[model samples]
Target: MEHSMFCYQCEQAMGGKGCTKYGVCGKSPEISNLQDLIIYQLKGIACYAKPLLEKGEHIDKEIVKFVENALFTTLTNVNFDLDFHLEMLKESQQVKETLRNKAPHGNYPEAATYNLSATKEEMIRDAVIAGVMYEVDLDPDIRSLRSTVLYGLKGISAYGHQARYIGHHSDQVDQFYFIALEAINNNNLTLEELIQMAMRAGDMSVEVMSVLDEANTTRYENPSPQKVNVNIKKGPFIIVSGHDLRDLELLLQQTEGKGINIYTHGEMLPAHGYPGLRKYKHLIGNFGSAWQNQQQEFDGIPGCILMTTNCLMKPRDTYKDRLYVTNVVGWDGIKKIELKEDNTKDFTEIIDKAIELGGFEKNEKEKEILVGFGHHETLSHADTIIKAVKDGKIRHFFVIGGCDGAKPGRNYFTEFAEKVPDDCVILTLACGKYRFNKLEFGTVAGLPRLLDIGQCNDAYSAVRIATALADAFETDVNSLPLTIVLSWYEQKAVADLLALLSLGIKGMYLGPTLPAFISPNVLQYLVDTFDIKPISTADDDLRNSLQQAN
Candidate 1:
């Protein structure tokens, strides 16, 4: 086989088709194939584990955790470490063997019985056959549904992994995961069955997101609306980025009074609103914009950088030495902070690096961004919101938030938010808000027009807010004056989209581009059934949405 690859698991897939030579996210062919092998090995493990789980047998905690993190590791821009991908593959096979040993004898498929004793070279070569293009005989629509469920499962794994760190567990979500993983290998399932499976995955994603929400609020009090400073303080400081709140908490505990300040970047901006985390005074504020601008914003920064989850770009040479990763996030030639024997990650290395770099010289800007308008906060204003609608003080509610990236045309989100009428309130979340978050949207119904509802996983909070509004108005969510315009990039957004559709909500304008994996038939199914749409201009979508609401 020629040394090549194909990956289309993201919104910016090359030409919106697939990446054949290398990933546009900076993943090399070697890393890509190794990730494929891990997925194949995981399928083998699931083949065995699902059956064992069915019989109510014991599966080790580590095995379950591995399955989740390995899926997360394969997400675009999350892990590009060649060695780490190989290591994950090795462990996945060990997990497969362990589960296989405990299984009752039965005729299992090749995925369940494949040998990993082949040389590394052979394993990489095998990935071409095992990767996304597998089951060449499968119907294109069926393939799209399968990819939908599979990719949504990746999102579930990401949230599930983070929730566990805060000591939350959900057997139902885990069971669904095992079933979905095993089912994806079955090519005989029809499109209807796959659609049902996809819906179930969406429902399961809700449960998983709920688990994470509970875990976060349980560990750190539910967020309240507060302003997060974006300017840097003069001192030895570290910029912690990505989506892992628990990791941020642990780092906060370790760095107390160490003469080092901590500033959040990207999705971590919401951390400053959590009561438990915000209590730390040295945990200063956010440092920059969304994940996509890191290469430029992070270039040659004096402070050390710690990435806890996804949204990693290929590092520029100037900042590589100052960068460190924790959890499942990985990149080649970068340092990592690993767990000790007691399962606690000592962030001493990054802390020391921040000290050595001498941190920021002074405050760069006086700007502060608002965050923490979670379900708890938004619901607190429920009576006011309902009254505003009744008095005709509020018109429509526009939900324009999701994952953000460096793709062209993402400016649509920024443009749409700007054009939202003053009578309507806007709800936003995730890193996507960086597009217009800095712009003042003023007030609606005595509340901030732009409500920063929290992180990507906090879509559950947005759902809660919407559902509560519908209940107050004596209608369902679809009947409420809500228009969802989303900007999606990767798998977390995939799960969020599924979760919304599972609730029977419709008319979500999605852009800057549609998923490459969704076949024409599957896309039509969504359009016909859910009234889903690809976004046009902000002016057109806004006009259409308002007209529909009337």
Candidate 2:
């Protein structure tokens, strides 16, 4: 084969192997090669950043920006333009050089030496020369585990970057990324070592999530239970997707009373709950379900889609012109609102486009979706929840949520949720809730049995609830009668896993396919430390989960 012309990095990769001849999602080989180079460069920068922390050097805002942009660029369905990747590489190298100059004698950790600054062609040629071709080259299980960690880190990087943008930074998270990246690149490390490293990554993720929680609540005020509309009113409108609230806030301000209505899409659904954002009458309702369903959901949808972050699929030609990208998300011919030096985005063009497109024919029927079950909102009902538990009305709590995917096994989530005992409460967030959100699980002591706790980033809500329950019962989080049955499809899930591990929340059931990235040794480490298990049949997994909780 004269060098495959396409590549695959998602769960639905063509033929169960990466697409090298043409991306199933339409990405060209040139783009794949560039993305690889970008990842390599990020690893290189991470390697460099690691030693700085050990040497007691502070990480400036620029370094954080570089790391965040690099990781965000590599997320599935984000940036697909080679030129964009080249620019990012140039920027990454510039940042690396600046950091090196500042810390000439600073510890240059081995992990930082992955040489990600090479041009795309150079990096691809080097890969060919090195003979490390694709995930198949490594041990299958190891490849899966490594990919899991990589994607998980990508998710963490996205959330971490957003938090930092809002003035929330975690030294431990930065350090953990450096250490984990270094460990992943280490050829001499044993499977046991890698597995332990994965768990450590999870532990570090806890601090990162906490930092984000503090940043979000302090900046936007904690989320409250709020019902959002799905009706599209007549006039121009903009649909904002992904999970960055800061970007959403900026767009909300820019489009304020501009006669352009705003709608939240995918993970952006939870934006309706924050006091700072909910006040906007123009913000409107959620457009669709998880990121994977956009092709069908967005088809023929009126108005423009303002992409603030990842989970962006390849756009169709019809709606392609209406899609706008900000931050690191980009595609050929797509209009992207660039962020200014102070991390501000100019959405003037997007607002104008919405006006040009106008919107749906008229004010559609109201589709009220339940959201805002974050820590603050959930805790507000603490007295009621505690009373339910004390009175034996709510006997069990099941956190059944994670990133959504196209896999057939995903239906198991709905099945499991339906099968959960009547006395059980299901706390969900992210895209996974679409599996069962439409089902009315009724109430346990006046609280809905199925709680929609914001988006995937809002997994922090589940953690907070777990900790509070533990505190109220005077026990450790692990000892509480709660079970976390998670399904992951991306990098953010990896970060969330790390957070759970860090907090010592054990006995988690993770499934819908074990990450193809985790090596057996690493998997074993998780099994031993966190007792993490993959989901089997819905009935079997549900039974096991309930038994563990009991």
Please, what is the whole-model Cα lDDT of each candidate in the order they appear?
Answer: 0.88, 0.76
**Local accuracy of candidate 2 as per-residue lDDT tens digits, 213-303:** 8888898888888888765677778889988899999999999878888889888888888898989888878776778888887786678
TM of each candidate vs. truth: 0.98, 0.90
**Lowest-sum lDDT 10-residue window in model 2:** 126-135
| Cα-based RMSD of candidate 2 | 3.0
Clashes of each: 0, 23
After superposition, candidate 1 runs with Cα above 4 Å error: none
RMSD of every candidate to native, in Å, equals 1.2, 3.0
